[model samples]
Target: MLATCLAQGTSGSPTVRVMSRDTQALLDTGSVVTLLRPVLAGGKAGEPMEVACVHGGTRTYDTCHVVIRTPHGVFTAQAGIVPNLPVPLLIGRDCPIFRPNKVWHVDGYDKLKPFGIAISGCIDGYSRRLMWLSSDSTNNNPAVIARYYLQCVSNCGVVPARLRTDCGTENGDMAAIQCSLREDHTDEFAGPLSHMYGTSTANQRIESWWSIFRKQRTQFWMDLFSDLRDRHYFNGTHEHKCLVWYVLLGIFQKELDEHRELWNNHTIRPVRQSLCPSGKPETMYHLPHRFGGRDCGFQVDPQVLQEFKDLLPPTNSLCGDDNLQYFANLERQSQLAPPINWPAAVDNYLTLKEMAGL
Candidate 1:
């Protein structure tokens, strides 16, 4: 058997040519029950056909059209027709994927306006699905991010094989959770390569999803009610602080929930030169194991979680004047007041009185 390296133009890709078509095939990565082409579709009888195949140049192939035969049922399938030689079935960074509890991306955005709504999000790197999205008075709390991580694993029935974060201090809480998963712990997150620490630019998948929510109503909604350009809304008028606050919070939560639905179902944008069929993240997330994809058997440790909960910062701290709400009485706006520490107020009053000798 002989082979020759076909030289490509400066802008063209190089190619390899074999002396004959009856060469032995080998797949070293894993066992191969059967040698098969990936592009053949089922529901049709197998047939040998010659088709024009163009890559660097046009050629013809006497390839057979047959579906993949797996021990199980036809596991999955995909086919595409391209105008030119299929887009270089290649591109920028390949989409990061791993079975659940294998990989996750963690980041928070603080782009909310004067009201300062902040949120933290986590995405399954493999499935490209949003694992967790949580908003609170603050996004900088390590404990809060950790709680969201715990909640995601608890509800989703999976843990990350690896975790990715933008190196923000708040994400450090994950380290404690990792530490809690000691040598004696189960295999839920036993992998040592648990976190992929990267920058905002490097963590593209989760960051791009943030734009989905931001585009919906980051500045647009806040500007609608708050005196965005005028004096500070917190001090300008009482209405700015209370009137539309709960309304803002209420509506945004609903929008975020709806946005998550739209996002989970949206077609994943293909990476630069990928030829794989675009898919919904939700499908990969929920049905991974059904189609030969692996699943990380992640189980949340209750005692470990309870121990971590004690280390988190208090989430009930009042950060702004507009932290208003409506509970049993939906029209209880009148009862809402900026969190006022009366002790500090009394001390300031007494000091002022002494200074004025009144």
Candidate 2:
């Protein structure tokens, strides 16, 4: 088995390391690596052994842990811990305590106890929900897509004077989004939605979003959710469900629907009273969706993304303290609006929309 690829051996597989006595602390220096016969000899002499084999004109390793048990004591001589099991073996290392074969019942089954049984299911109920929302929804509700998009926005940290979204009906209007310079500073968030790229492009962002989502949240959930199985970083956490609704809303124009709470108490920056009489009217501060660009009212031709290189500065050239701050704030915001009972949230939206008669 070790000679073929069907099983791996510490002798050479990249994933497995074969250690020497110095490394293992189990075997001694100059101690030979060998294999003991699995079956005992007819008399009290016990099993004969030889280290590693060159048989049929081929050098091969063993898959079993065959070792000698002398009257002095039994030691791991060869067949290092099922070598083909892909375990590392340090040569000359002192072998660990050994499990010896005892008297056995004629029936064979009379001895060992049964191993426990286990079960599993789709553990990441939340990630599964997000995947469902992203793949199923046509609205691209900012609420549903909130988790993924906001994470990126938070991660990127550039609160642009303008923002862009694919022309999906979901990002229809950046209802909740708003941006403005810290002061009458040079940068006014300005950028246009990429109307040319369709849902295919949307899916790409979705995939990337899943990658990050899994990285941040899955391991924690797996540690807690299932002892028998593992949870994926993306498909396994409840936060994924909560995050989906937020991303959905952000993608949809529904962001404006939620921003009301943020503005009532959200402090974007310190009031530069010297700059404005009323210490900077809170209403004046706006995000990209609130003003400017093709999504809001400006005429941005769809061709610009192809020539985006000419439109915006390179990342290193453009990034500065503010970009970092913006990213930090975005991450904070994700914490703020983690996923809620989304079905209820949607039902509330429908109820409100019906009341509004639009």
Candidate 3:
């Protein structure tokens, strides 16, 4: 006996096969339209529609409605017919199964440490634009992360419809602030719901960006630090770590700023499967309407933002005060100028290390 059920439609119509245990479905948030194979839609073609593909091109496909039964409930969804679809079903963001909430993804990268550096970043999910990318001694501090979020809001003159982050203690202050800011709003995603906590793996937008960041930027820094460790110049001592932070933090931040500029201005190639727009991130973010996207940012009053900023903890230094002062004194005594480049930074690091008897 066949494992799948075959249901008969009206007379002279092809039979529809119900989904079986072996059928595969993909939930793609990046896609704007749900899709189904012709076989799954009774082998009948509906009206024709032009859809964008991954290769910066468009393809015409038939459209139909399919009844999807899930453990949660059963619903009918409009789907395009793709003859060569790898999966039986593809669910996109436009489906009713997903909440229509706009969000910003926030996370930290600790991959650069021992050199005493951390990276905190936020990206607008709608445009995939980097809102802020900051390098510091530590990013796991709640106050520090909150400040970054608020600073971005202040600069942009708007707040995201929602904020999404991992369920880490480091996100506590940010979550609280988001809730406070939206407490009076009437939207479904306002109030406590304004901030969402999920695993880092599920934070797809920023997580995806991190891979690109590693390939384009962070790998070089990782290699540089590894080289220093291999040469025994960086012994991983607390004082030595502080020295590295003091000498290289500014340079690292400058590099991060440059990388942000390049990333925002560069053109993103089109992908056939993704429904998100492909263009310069800066343009897409500021002028979303050009690509059929609406700005999901909420305007907040500057005075209200200032009030929240006043509640945040004072900003912390990248390294210990004593260590920074000690290094400054050594530089003054040696009459060596502050580093303007990597070679100068290395020379100053070695000279200071030797002077401090490390």
lDDT, candidate 2, 1-358, per-residue tens: 1111111122211121122111111211112232222231122232222232112123433334334443234444334332332223432212222111000000001000111111000000101112111221122333333333333234334322232233444343222332211123332222221111222222222333334334553343333324312323223232333232233333222332333233223333332111111111123222222222111122222333224223332222112345435433554644434325444434433333233232
Residue 79 of candidate 2: its Cα lDDT?
45
Our model 1 lands, by Cα RMSD against the true structure, at: 13.3
Residues forming the 10-long window of minimal summed lDDT in candidate 1: 1-10
Show where candidate 1 strays beyond 4 Å: 1-97, 182-192, 217-219, 222-227, 230-247, 269-277, 310-313, 320-358
- Give residue 127's error in model 1 in angstroms: 1.6
The TM-score measured for candidate 1 stands at 0.56
**TM-score for all models, in order of appearance:** 0.56, 0.18, 0.76
lDDT tens per residue, model 1, 202-319: 4655665566666775656555435433533244233333332333454556566676777779887653222222478798777776534666545566766667677776665233
Q: What is the C-alpha lDDT profile of model 3 across 88-167, one tens digit per residue?
A: 66655444443222578898987887678889998776566788999888887898999898889889887777787888
Question: Highest TM-score: which candidate?
Answer: 3
Candidate 3: lDDT over CA atoms?
A: 0.72
Give the Cα-based TM-score of candidate 3 against the true structure. 0.76
